[model samples]
Target: MSLAADLGIAFGRVAFVMLFVLNMGGLLTWVERKQSAIMQDRIGANRASILGLRLFGLFHPLADAIKMLTKEDFRPARADRVLFGLAPFVSVFFALTAFASIPFGDTLRVGGREIPLQAVTLNVGVLYVFAMLSLGVYGVMMAGWSSGNNFALLGGQRAAALMITAEVAIGASIMGVIMVYGSLNMMDIVRGQGALLWGWLPAWGIVTQPLAFVLFLTAGIAATKRIPFDMPEGESEIIGYFVEYSGMKFGMFAMADFLETVVIAGMTTSLFLGGWQVPYLDAAGVRLPWGWTWALPHLLVVLLQVGAFVLKVCAVIFFMMLIRWTLPRFRYDQAMRLGWLGLFPLSIANIVLTGLVLLLWGGRP
Candidate 1:
């Protein structure tokens, strides 16, 4: 294929993936609300329907989009209009960009052409993910500061500090993963997990690094600034960083939250649950019969691998959504304490323990 043609094909495929992710995230907002309402024993969004069709709150997302579209797109008179416009855009844009390096699934082959699901397989994918996640704070900070509102400023300050506290612990917690895998490439980490531990439990990161998994989960929750770590946008006591934002602008920030959830879920799959490789599935992938030729085996193998990957990703997403609804929001000081005094020490301990495990097991994990 010509280089230009190849580039076009790659872009087209990526566009499709982005659209899929977008629609999924939009749906998730309604799901989160409906699920949250169900937990609280109330009708979440039954009032929002189309043609008298409730569809179990399926139409809520469309309703939300319309509301955001018609709402006044107002800016504070004293706010920096340029930065105000850019703030949510920055938040949503970085959230989307962070997904670029993730390996969603394995490659598929058709007529001798193989297409990989990952957008860009950068060598420093892990670092890049972290960097983008950290940068997410700036969007909030800018939004709050540029609003020229005291409440917004306070929220932004809280967000910055909250992010730093959680990020340090989060970064420390994942060091063990790096130590074990010895590579920053997320694809390689998943590939490493395909082996079995003593022929039993899969050698997924969670199996081998159980403590790290817990710590990582905790920090991830805090990093994403959801409940139990939502000090930055505590709706009750303090207006959130984006309090000044409205209309589709605010919708972008809301959408970014859902996208970040998906990103985290996907990363969890790649990091701990073994990306696209089921136990015993080799790096090149499994094989099956393609009618009457050798191509059959290759096709089957690829199909199995894709199935495995989707299963893993779905499992992760379910777990995250469960956590979101099950937990209560943490108070600002409590969240801070958990991040610093609690998670920080635990993360450091995990690093130390991981080293010992590596020394004893010769890094087989």
Candidate 2:
């Protein structure tokens, strides 16, 4: 409608997405502890509470926030003050912005005006998200180099190397999905997935590009720089890129990691797990393969799509956490080998195979 209304809608969408991303990032700190506890057969983070309200350590994140806020903001005496101060913000900013292009649901029609559920709609959303994620490396490098610490510099070098190895594989891995969807738009890709194959199976990326799914997920985990790929922050060795950071600055770096995890999960859900698409469910309602149709209200349909997307993202997050507990950290050399000699070539092969299959089939299968 009017320019003001359009701006208002855009602002609203941005607000909603930011709140969701930040809150999830915070909650994931709790999830990580609790999930790890259950897996290791121990109680975790249950001590933080207020007025006899434990809430199963739900208050830990809140307690963490307060502690970080009140802690002394420290900087190394030899550090470059400007870049050292700016790095954490850069990391958090890019991580949060990357989620802007992710579509949480389909269009929401209200008062005869259609509003997209995503914060931003881009013709090249995949590239946009990837670029944002790649930019985060600068923050890591900045944090390490500006800290004026030898250990931090070494950590930065490792981080850069790991990022390079993983990013190449990640870029190559998504090529097959692009070929299958035949569009760079994230919404287009998700919409393409809603179609049924053989009038029975949903045409999700996992079905069409199963190899890409596995490769992307593997590379995505490496990109997040978590356990088994966390040589950049080898705490066991008492070193890291942000080793000199303290207080909220350090918190920002930690938050950035969790935010990246959420972004990776969102990307996996969007690219391979059908995004907001529900089985047999369209904008109007559910139309089963066996001639059964259930018409749902527009609001309900939107809610269902959004809910499905949320659930899928959560499931992916849970799986990632499970992997975190299950696997031991890989040695740097082994991690690099897996990314370069293993995932990279496999991703390239997957692309070629996808191309051949599409050529023979004449379209998505």
Candidate 3:
């Protein structure tokens, strides 16, 4: 492609990722409220409305934006002003940028041109995501340390410890995936998943590497600082890292959390759920392993693939929200034990076992 075309593609991908992540984040806020309300037998977020049409609390996010925006921007008088102000932006920026390497669909061919559906096809996309996630910790640490509050500093310490611990399992689990797929490229992994196992089952990561999937999902939730592992922002007791923050700064932190959830969901879908892969469907038509074939329009095929990817992401997000609402928070000691003693070893063993099986079977990469 020409330089101009490359630039245009880059811009388009960036715009698409931003809008997708933000929209998912907004929708998840509503999902959290509605799901919790349903689980607790209560009405949820139904008061926000426009023109007397509530749309089942669909307007709540907008109302929240207005409320937060209109609130006073508060900061502690003795706090580190620069770091406190910079913290939430750091959180939000990393959350947004981390989704760039995850592929939402396989590819699209329009007219005479073929375009990949991901933002950027980095050779080490998996590593890139890990790097971004690791860097995200700085935001929380800064928020807590800059606040000059003992409680906030404690929360920051917990966050750093939890992330560092969980990341070991997360990295190990993904290493299994990299070994199975035999590539660090996200697109290649997604394409590899398009194959069929035993001429019937779709060769998704969940099927081939179920243990890694579980470990990765668990560690991913911990990395995002969600339920069962949310000691960092234990709002009920321990003051959170952003406890002293208010107004849009606090909103930014909230937004970053939701966006991080979406990113995790997307990554889970892409890595384990056969991203953009509709069974028996390809760019041209449906082709089954049993010698069956059916032609489909190119546009229809593209729609099917994209729809499958989106549906998988939404399903994973729903499951994650359910987990957040249903699971009890882990004690700090228990969380640490699970991360270091439980998940880490399992992830490592999973890698070794996967390698042995692949070696014995001489599996094709």
Candidate 4:
């Protein structure tokens, strides 16, 4: 392919990822309200509508956008103008960029060329995503410290501490997966998961590294800083990091949180689930364990893979939202303790166990 074509493909992938994430993040706002309402046995977000058409509260996100856009943008009298203004953008930017490395489908072969379905392909994609996610804390710190509010500063400190605890546990937890897959590339790891164990069971990360999956999901939830791990924004007690933000600025912060949740779900899908890999399905066709072989077109196979990825991601998001409504918020001290004294050591132990199992099995999974 020519350089121009390559660049075009890259841009197309980027556009696809951006649109998918942004739409999902926006839709999640409605999902949260509706799902919570179902759990609590109440109507939620049905008030927003146009021309008497509610569309089952789907219009609420649009209503929210209008409200945020029309509301007055406020800044503290003693705030640092530049950093305070830039913080929300930083948070949203990193959250969006982190998804670039996640592969939603296998390569699409078209007209003598193969195109990857990911926005960006990198050998160290996992580390790249981790770095991007870790950098998001800077935005939180900036928002808090520049707000000129002691409460905000305390929230920022809590966020920083929680981030440290979560990141460490996350890093340690994924080491077992890295050992199992023997790859740092996200695509490579997902491809590795396509292998079948004992001619039947798919060799997914959750199958081989169940412990890592649990550890990673726990730490990933903490990384997103949602319910049960929302120490940075304990609205009932402390107003938390972006307390001084208002209008669209506050909306951006909120959007960043949802984007982070989507990223976590995507990462979990790529790492622990099978990403876009469908069981008994390969590039050519479906190969059943019981001696049945069904051939499928390449385009159809690609579509199936992509569809499976989307479904997996949505399922993970639903589970996350379920947890959000089912669990109460964690106290700061309790969250910190869970992160450090609980998850961290357990993650380390999981790594050691994985290494031993890999060694005993001749590094095969």
Query: Top lDDT: which candidate number?
Result: 2
How do all models score by TM-score?
A: 0.90, 0.98, 0.97, 0.98
All candidates: CA RMSD (Å) = 3.6, 1.0, 1.4, 1.1
Q: By lDDT, highest first, what's the ranking?
A: 2, 4, 3, 1
Clashing pairs in 4: none
lDDT for each residue of candidate 3 in 231-272, tens digit (9 for 90 to 100):
999867767788999998999998998888888888899889
lDDT of 4: 0.93
Give the CA lDDT, 0 to 100, for residue 81 in model 3.
88
**Candidate 1 at 173: error in angstroms?**
1.4
Comparing 1 and 3 by lDDT, which wins?
Answer: 3
Per-residue CA lDDT of model 1 for 1-365, tens digit only, reads 66886797689667855875677789788878877888789888877766788988888899889999999999989898888999998888888888777776666566566777677767998888888888998988898899999989998899889888877887888788888888898877877787777655578888877887888777887777777677788766668888988899989987887887777777777787777776655545432223222233666776677677667766766677778778888888888888899999998999999899889888575
Q: lDDT per residue, candidate 2, 145-191, as tens digits?
A: 99999999999889988988888999999999999999888999999
C-alpha lDDT of candidate 1 relative to the true structure: 0.79
Backbone clashes (count) for model 3: 0
Q: Rate the local accuracy (lDDT) of all candidates.
A: 0.79, 0.93, 0.89, 0.93
Candidate 2 accuracy as lDDT: 0.93
Model 2 poorest ten-residue lDDT run: 231-240
The per-residue C-alpha lDDT of model 1 at residue 257 equals 78
